[model samples]
Target: MKTTKILLAGMTALLLASCGTHKTLMEQKPAPGDTPRPAADSTSHKLSYVQHISDKALYQKNVVSNLTFTVNNGRKDITVPGILRMRKDEVVRLQLLIPILRSEIGRIEFTKDYVLFIDRIHKQYVKAGYNDVAFLRDNGISFYTLQALFWNQLFIPRQQRVSEADMSQFSVDTHRLEVDGSAKIVLRDGKMTYKWVIPALWDQIAHTAVSYTSPTHGTSELSWFYEDFRPFGSKQFPASQSVEIHTPAIGQRPAKTLKASFELDGFSDAGDWEPFTTPSDKYKKVSVEEILGKLMNF
Candidate 1:
C-alpha cells in the first residue's frame, strides 16, 4: 500500500510539472519583430481606472508653467510663462514663443478639428486640418494635439492611435510605465508608426522618452522632464516642462535635432479660451505651394 501511495504522488508531481510548462509556454510573447499587422476590432477596449488616472491628472484647476527643449543639432530651447487653461471639448491654448518669427505666439487655439496659429508679432493666422498637421512636407504654423497626457477626454487615447494589432486591430502592448506615472503604448499603422506616452504620475511626468516614426520622415523622439508641481488655485500645476526632438536621416540630410523649452511662470485661467484674431494687414496667408517654394531658405 505504501509503495502504491508513493507511486501516485510521483505521478501527481509529473502532471503538475507538465501543466506548469504548458502555462509558461502560453505566457511567452514573441520578441518584437516585423509581424504583419492584423485587423482591429470595431469596438475599443474600455479603459480601466489606472488608465484614466493619467487623464485625470491632467485636468488641473490651476495654470501650468514649464520649460521645453527641442534638440536637433544641439539644443534649441524655448521658455514660455503662461497659464494652461482648458475647457473640456472646447479649446486648449498654449501661450508660447514662435521661434521662426522670433516673438510670442500669444495663443495657440485648437478646437475639435482645426488648429489655428495666431502670430503675436504680426497678428496673422495659419490654419491646418488636424490630420494634415502630420503631412509636414513644408514649414508653416500647424497645430498638433497635446491631449494624450489627460484622460477622460479622448474616446481612444492618443497613445493607442498606432495599431500594430493582433488578429484584431486593438491588440497592443504596454511600452513603459513612466516615472511621472503614465503608461506608454506602441502601435503601428502601415508605414506610419505612432507612440502615445501619457503622464503616469500625479501632476508630473519626469524623465520620460516617447517616440514616433514613419517610413518617409524616419523617427522622432520626444523626451519630457518635469520639475515642480505647485498648487495654482484648486489644482496642481507643472512649474516647468522640457521637450527634445530627434529626427533620423530625413532624405539625404543627416539626422536633424531640435530642442525647445517652455517655461511657465504666472498662470491665470481668467481670460476666455477664444481664438486669437490676427490683424488682417499684418501678414498674408501663404499657400502650401508658396511655402514649398522657399525650401532652399530652410
Candidate 2:
C-alpha cells in the first residue's frame, strides 16, 4: 500500500511537468563606495553588455538537423529519431519516426499564427490557428515562445514582434550559482530571467533556463541544456539538449511537467523547409472542438 501511494505521487509529478515553452544588454548599479562616473560613461557601460551578447547570438536564416528524441510524460517513455528544420521567426517543422519500425509516426509544423499536427499512424491531421487549440489558447501559448525555446534563442514575452525588444530592460550578472567548475550567467528583467551555466571562459552556455508568469498563464518555466556544441559557419550549436517545462498547478489539473532530451546526428542551416501538405482525401479532418474534447477527456 505504501509503495503504491509513492508511485502514484511520482507519476503525478511527471504528468504535471509536461508543457512547453533573451537578450542582453546590461547595466550594473555601482557600489556606493564607487566614484560617480560621467553620464556618457555610464551609458557606455550599459551598452557594452548588449554588445557582448549580440556577438554570441545565432540568429540563423534556417537550420536543419537530425536529432534523437527521448521523452517521458509520467506514464511512459518513448525514444524516436526525428528531423527538425527551423527558420527563425518564420516556421519550425519536426518529423518523428518509430525507432526500429522506421515508420513515420508524427509531424508538427508551427508558423507565426498557426499550428499543424499530423498523426500518420491514425491518418488524422489538424491544422488550425493557434487560438483554435483549447490548451494553447487557454494557457496563452504563442508560436514565438515555442520557437525561441526550440531555436536556442533568448526570448522576451508578449512582445508580438521581435523588434520591440528593449535593451534597457535587461541587466547582466556574472556571479551566481556554480557547479562542476561552471558558473551561471544571468540576464534579468522584472519577472523573467534568462540564465545560462557555462564554463570559466564564458564563451557559450551549457544550459539555459527561462521562467515567467502571466495573469492568464500563471507560472510557466522552461530550460534547455546544451553540450558538445557543434560548428556551423562562425557559430556553434549544442549537439545535445536537455529540455524541461513546468506549468503551475492550476484549476482542476495537477501541475504538469514535460521533459525531453535530444542529441544531434546531423545538422545544416540551408534548405527548402517546405511543410507537409495534407491530401484532401488522405486523412479524416476534425474540428478544433473535437481535438479539445479528446485531450480533455484523456
Candidate 3:
C-alpha cells in the first residue's frame, strides 16, 4: 500500500487538480474568535445571496507558498512541501519539494494553450493541450475550470467559458441548505449541481462542490474545501485547502480517486513562472498513452 501510494502520488501527473491582510477586512471573523475581515468585494455586493457565488472576477493575481502538500486515496498517502504562483488568464505554476534537502521532486505549469508536468528527479515530462490528452479530451477539465478553482471562484461545466453573465443564466432547479448554521447555496442544472457557502466574516467563496454524470463514462465528482483563513493585502485567503477528484468504476475497470491537501505557510508574488523547458534530445518524448501506462505500472 505504501509503495503503491508513493507511485500513485508521484505519478499524479494528471491529478486534475487564494488572501489576505487588509485591516478593514480583518475587522470581523467569518467565525467567532477568528480574525476580523474586510467587507465583501465590489463584485460580491452586486449579486444577491445566491448570485454572489458565481462571481468570476472573485480575485486578482497572487502567489502563495510555504505549503504542506499531500495526495491520498485510502491506498496511498504521500506528503511533501510545495509552492504555487498563479494569475488569472495568465498562468498557474506549482512545485512540490523534498523537505529535509529542499529538493524539488516535481512541478506542473498551466497556461491557456497548454499544460506541462515535469518529474524533475527523473527528467520526464508531459507537455500538451487538453485536447492532446485523449483521456481528458472529453472530461469537463479546462484552463478556465482550473483557473476558477485556484482563484476561489464558482465554476460551471460546459458553458463555453467562465463569465458572470453565463453564470447568471445558469439558474435551473435551484435550492439551498442550512448546515451547521451556514446556508449552502445549491444550484442544480442538467446532470450537475454547484454548491457553496460563505464561511464567516470573509465575503468570498470558501468552498465549492461539483458533481457530474455521463452515461458512457460513469460518474465523476470534484470538490475544493478551504480553511485557515488569513489576511492578505486587503483580503483574507484560505491558507489551508483540500482538493478532491473521484471517478466511479466504468465497465470492467475499477474506480479511481485522488485527494490533495495543502497549507500555505507563505503567500507572496515574489517568484517567476515560465513554460517547462523542452527536454534535450537525450530524453525520450512519449504520447499520453505511454505516460498513463507508465504511471499505472509504477
Candidate 4:
C-alpha cells in the first residue's frame, strides 16, 4: 500500500510540472530576467538615466545591409533574401529578391511624405500617404513611429523626433529589475501605450512594444525584438530583429497576427542606392489593400 501511494504521489508531481511548463510557454508577457533589484529612488534621476542611455545608443547616418527577411501570417511562412537601406530621417527601404538568381521581387519603402510598395512579381505598386492606408490610418501610426522602431529609439507621435524635453513624458519601472535585472520604460499618449524593455547589463533596447486600444476599432499591439548586436561606429546595432503585430477580431474579419523577422548579414554606412523609386508606367497602380493582400498571400 505504501509503494502504491508513492507511485501516485510521483504521478501527481509530474502532472503539476507539466502544467507549469505549459503555462510558461503560453504566456504572452515578457519573461523577467533572473537577477533582482529594487526600484530607483528618485523619479527625476530615473528619467535622467533613461535619457542618457537613449543618447548614447543613437545611431545616425545612412545604413545598408543584406538581410534575410521572413514573414509569417499564421497560415503560411515565406522567407527570402533582401536588402535594407536607411537614409537617416529620410527613408527606409526593403527590397526582397528571388533567392538564387538574386533578382528583385518586391520592394517596400517608407519616407516622411508617403509610403511606397512595389510588387515586381505582379507589376503592381502602391504610393499613398499614411492617412490613405487603412492599417496606418486606423492605428494612428506614422513614418516617425516606423523610424523609431528601425533605429531603436524612442519617439512621440506626430513629431518628427523626440527631443530632450520630451523625455519627461516617459515613466520608468525598475521593480521588474529586482526580479530579472531588466527595466521597462513606458509612455502613454491618449489610448496608445509604448513600452521598451532594456535587459540587464545592456544599454541598448532589447525589445519594444506599442499597443493601442479603442472601443470602436478594437485593439492592436506591435512588438519588436532585437538581438545579435554588432558594433557600429561607437555603438552596438541589432543585427537580428523580429516584429509581430497582433490585431483583435473586428466583426467577421476575426483576429489576425503578422510576424516579420530580419537577420542582417552585415552593416554599412554606404549611401550608393537611390533613396526613392518611381514606379514605371508598365506597373499598374493598385489600391493599398489590393497590393498588401497580394504581398501577404505571397
Best by TM-score: 4
> lDDT by residue for model 1 over 152-257, one digit each (tens)?
2222222332222332332233323313223444434443333333333332233444445555665555444444555556445555554454557756577644
Residues 64-142 of candidate 4 have per-residue lDDT tens digits of: 9998877664655567788999987889888877778998877778898897767676687778898886656655677
Count of backbone clashes for each model? 39, 11, 19, 3
CA lDDT, every prediction?
A: 0.38, 0.57, 0.58, 0.69
**Against the correct fold, how does model 4 do in TM-score?**
0.83
RMSD of 4: 12.9
lDDT of 2 at 254: 81
Off by over 4 Å in 4: 1-39, 292-298
Q: For model 3, state the Cα shift of residue 35 in Å.
A: 16
Model 4 residue 189 distance off true place after TM-score fit, in angstroms? 0.8
TM values, all candidates: 0.53, 0.71, 0.76, 0.83
* Overall local distance difference test of candidate 1: 0.38
lDDT of 2 by residue, 1-298 (tens): 3332222223222222222331221222222233211133354554454444434557567888886877756566656787778877778777776667666666667788776766666677767886765545544557776666665555555554334246555444423322233344455655566665444444555567776666765867777766666677777676777676776777787876666677786788775756445535878876656654454432
Put the candidates in TM-score order, highest first: 4, 3, 2, 1
State residue 123's C-alpha deviation in candidate 1, in Å.
5.6
Root-mean-square deviation (CA) per prediction: 20.7, 8.5, 7.0, 12.9
Minimal lDDT window, size 10, model 1? 17-26
In terms of TM-score, which candidate is stronger, 3 or 4? 4
